[model samples]
Target: MWWKTARTRLDLGQRGMIMGILNTTPDSFSDGGSHAGVEAAVAHARQMIADGAAIIDIGGESTRPGAGEVAVAEEIARTAPVIAALRAEWAGAISIDTMKASVAAAALEAGADIVNDVSGLTADPDMERVCVESGCGVAVMHMQGDPRTMQVAPDYEDVVAEVRRFFEERLLSLVAAGIDAEAICFDPGIGFGKTVEHNLALLRALANLNVGGRPLLLGVSRKSFIGRVLGSTDLADRSWPTVAITAWAREAGAMIHRVHEVRPNTQALRMTEAILQGGNSAFSG
Candidate 1:
C-alpha cells in the first residue's frame, strides 16, 4: 500500500504512520491556539517531523463539533504561510486539512501534498477539481453532519456498515473526478458524527470496510469519544487512551494514525510493530 503524491510517497502497512495534527485555530477541541500563528505552527511542524511523524496534517479551521466555520480567505491566510515555510525546510508529507476548495488550492500552491478533507469532498463542489488538478493525495472522511450540528444528534443503524457504504460511494465520485485511485485513502471519520458506540464499532470493524485495498486512516487522538469512554472530559487525560487505541488499531489493520502528541503514539506503534514481528521477549533472539 503506497500513497503517492507528485512530491511524496508513503509505504503504508510497512508500519503504522503517524500524522501529527497541527490546528491553527483558536477553537479546536485540543491544543487549538497553541500553534495559531505562522511561526509557532512552523516550529511545531519541525518538532513533529523530528519526533518521527511521517506526515504533518495542518488545519486552519477547527472541525471540532459545533465549531463555526472559518472563511476561505482566513483559512488560507492561517495555513498557507506555515505550509510554505515547512515545505522550504522540511522534506516530509504535508497534508492540508480543510474542506474548502480555495484553501486547498492555496495550500497546494504553498507546498502541501495532501488534501485531508473532513467533508469527504462533499463540502465544496470545486474541491474535486482542485485535487484533480494538483494531483495531491486525498483523504476523504465521513462526517455525519456539519461540525456545528453533527454531535447534537449522531444517529446510525449499524454505523460500520453505513460508513463503508459512504466510502464506497465517495470513492467512485472521487475517481470519476480524476483522482488516481492509488493516491486515495479512506478515513471512517471517527468522532466526526459518531456516538461512543458508533466510534468503537467502526474501529472494531475496520477490516470489513470494502475499499479495494486503500489504506484506512484513523484519527481518534484526544477526541471527545475517547473522553466519553474513559469518563474524563479533560483533553489531557485522553492521551493514554489515544495511544492505546493506536496500538489496538494498528493490530486491527489501521495503516495511519492522525495524532496530536506524536512521540508517544510513535512509541506505541513501534512497540506493537515489534511484538507483531515476533520480538516478544528479550531472549527470543
Candidate 2:
C-alpha cells in the first residue's frame, strides 16, 4: 500500500512508519512548551529523524481535553516557521496537525506535505476544500466532540462500530470531495474523547477499522490512557507501554505510529517488522 501526499508517497506496505510529534504549544498534555520555537523544534525534529521518524508532525494548538483554542494567526506563527526551517534543512515528510483550515493553509504554504487534522476535516468549514486543492495527505480521525468538551461525558453505544462507521462515512465523503482515496488514512482518535475501555477496545480492533482499504494511523504515545492503565501518572512509566503498543499496533497492520518519544518506538517498530518478516536466523536466542 502507498500513501500519496503533496510532496511524497510513502510505501506503507514495506514497513510501519513513525510520525514524530512536535507540539509547539504551552498547554498540550504532553511536551507542551518543550519545542515551542523554530530552533528548538528543528533541533528536536533532527533528533527524531536520526532516531527513525519517517514524518515530523507539527502542531500549534493543544488538543488535550479541555484545551482552550488558539487563534489562527497564533497557530500559524507557532508552526509555519518550524515547518519552513525543516523543509529547508531536510526533505522528509512533514505534517501540520491542526483542525482549522487557515492554519493548515499556512503550514502547507510553508512546505508541509500532510494535514493531520484530528477533527477529520469537520471542525472548519473550508478544511475539505483546502485539502482537496492542496493535494496533501489527509489523516481523518474520529473524535466524539471538540477538544474542549470531548471528554466531558463521552458516550457511545458501541465504540468500535461507531468509529468504523465514522471511518466509512469519512472515506466516502473525502473521496467525493475530490481527495484521492490513497491520499487518505484513518485514525481512531485514541484518547480524544475516549475512556480507558474505549481506547483499549479500539486498539483491539485496530485491523478492523481500516475502511476502504486505507491504512490506519495509531497515536498512543504517552497518552493519559496509557498512564491510567499502568496505574501511573509519571510520563517515564508510560514509555515502555507506549513502545509495547507500537509493536502491537504494527503486528495488527497499522501503517503509521504517531509518537512523542521517537527512538524507543522506532526500535519497537523495526523489531516487530523484522520479526514479522521472518527468515532472520541471525538471532539464535
Candidate 3:
C-alpha cells in the first residue's frame, strides 16, 4: 500500500523517498548539538526541505547507544517547539522521532505529521493509541533493547526471519488496535541492536521484508557499520558511504530513506530509479 504523508506518496513497490533527519538533541550520534536550539533546528529543517527532502524527521532525545534517557517533559520541551515552527514554515511532512507516547502526542498536536517510534510501538502502550487517534502516519522500527545496552552482545540466530516475525506481530497488534495498514511503515532498525555482521546481513537481505505491501523505511545514515567497513570513526566523514547505502536500499525495495544528507542522496535515488525503470526519459532529464 502507498502511504500518503504531507508531501510524498510512498508507493510501496516503487523507488524510495527521502526522510531528512533533524535531531534536536545535544548528543545524537551525528549532527546533534549542531541544531540543538530552536532557531538552528528550524533553519536546518528549512535547508533540508530546500534540498529536496520529502519528510523532515525531528528527534528531541538522543538514542545513541549508552545515552541516558530524557524525561517526558524534557523530550516534549525539546521537540514540540521545533515541530511547531517547522509545521508553520515548511510545506513538507514532519515526523516526530520519539518513543514516548506523551512526546509523540504533543508533537502531533503541535503539527507534526508522523510518529517515528524507534522501539516499534513496544516502548509505550499508548503509542498505538496515539497513532490511531491522530490518524497520522507511523514508522515502527525494530530495536532489540533500549539504547543504553542494545548493542551489548546483541544476538539473533536468523536476523531476517526474526525481524520479519517481529514486524508481523507488531503489525497485527497495531491493526487490531484500529490503526490502518496504509498509515504504517517499517524500519529494520539498523545499528540499533545488531553487530556489524548482522547489520550487513540485514542490508543485503532487505528485499526479503516485503511485509504485505507496507512501505519500508531504511535508515543507515552514518551508522557505525559504515565506519567498520571503511575503517573510519568520524561520522561526519561518511556521507559518500551513506549515499551508497541509500542507493543499495533503494535497489533492495526500500520505499523511504531516512538520511542526514538530502541533496546528494536525492540525486542518487533519481538516477538509480531512472536506471531501474528502464531509463525512463522523464527521470533522466
Worst 10 residues of 2 by lDDT: 276-285
Each prediction's Cα RMSD?
2.7, 2.3, 2.0
Error of 2 at 206 (Å): 0.8
TM-score to true structure, per model: 0.96, 0.97, 0.95
Across 1-285, the per-residue lDDT of candidate 2 in tens digits comes to 999999889999868888999999998887888998999999999999998899999999999998899999999999999999999989999999999999999999999999999999998989999999999999999999899999998899999999999999999999999999999999999998899999999999998887888999999988888888888979889888999999999999898999988888888887887788873412111
User: How well is each residue in 172-274 modelled by candidate 3, as lDDT tens digits?
Assistant: 9898998888888899999999999889999998989878678889999888888888898887768998998887888888869999989888888887888
lDDT of 1 by residue, 170-190 (tens): 888889889999888999999
Q: Candidate 3: which pairs clash?
A: none
Q: Is candidate 1 or candidate 3 better by lDDT?
A: 1
> What is the descending TM-score order?
2, 1, 3
Give me the runs in candidate 2 sitting further than 4 Å from their true place: 279-285
- Candidate 3 overall lDDT versus native: 0.86
- Alpha-carbon local distance difference test for all models: 0.89, 0.91, 0.86
